[model samples]
Target: MRIRVDDLSGEATRSLIAHHLADMRATSPEESCHALDVDALREPAVTFWSAWDGDDLAGIAALKDLGAARGELKSMRVADAHRGRGVGRALLHHVMGAARARGLSTLWLETGTPPAFLAARRLYADEGFTECGPFGDYVNDPFSVFMMRLL
Candidate 1:
């Protein structure tokens, strides 16, 4: 698989992001859904990436520079066809390495607590992320699980 920075312009990337957003909304309450849309992911502070397998998109992920030596992981999704193929882990390690290279000391993320999100939560835990209180603009929400990892 080839992992590269994405400008959020390709049809496959846009479609995947749309699917991710829709899935998040369908799985969680509107108020508890924090997934970003295409425009939001295009923000200057965020860097998006797409993992590709030949002509197919394998997955997508993003890293947000939170300033002050901290960063946030966002929009991590492994395409259905690529699940269990290490795409998620590869994207995660790529983002983590980018954060560390940027001199960030920590990484943060917010995911849902529903059964549908079990794999994601487990992946984070396995990667050394531990539960934490809400950070940044987030507030307490029973449906949201916040996690943090030192880089």
Candidate 2:
């Protein structure tokens, strides 16, 4: 699969991002859902990417610049057809590399705490992210798990 910076305009990318937002809302409370919509992802602070295998979109991920050499991982989603195929891991690494390229030294993320998010949490842990208190504009949230890694 190949990963590239996304403009958030393609139909497939838009559809996948909508589906990701819907899933986040369904699994987590509205107040705790931090997933950004397509418009939000287009903001200057966020850099979005889509992974593709030929004509198929394999996954999506984004890095939100938090300034001070920090970034927040956002909108990570592997297509249903690509689940368990290392798509997520690839996207994660792609975003991490992008962050490092931008001179970011730390990466942060907020994911769900429910069982639906277990695999995601495990993936982050396997990649060396550790649990941490909320950073940025986030406050302590029971439904959210915050993680961080120094690059």
- Model 2, 1-151: lDDT tens digits are 8999999989999999989999999998999999999989999999999999999999999999999999999999998999999999999999999999999999999999999999999999999999999999999998999999999
lDDT of 1 by residue, 44-147 (tens): 99999999999999999999999999999999999999999999999999999999999999999999999999999999999999999999999999899999
- Segments of candidate 1 deviating more than 4 angstroms: none
RMSD of each: 0.6, 0.6
lDDT of 1 at 104: 97
Regions of model 2 farther than 4 Å from truth:
none
Candidate 2 lDDT for residue 88: 98
Distance from true location, Cα of 25 in model 2, Å:
0.8
TM-score of model number 2? 0.98
* Clash pairs, model 2 backbone: none
Q: What is the lDDT of candidate 1?
A: 0.96
Number of clashes found in candidate 2: 0
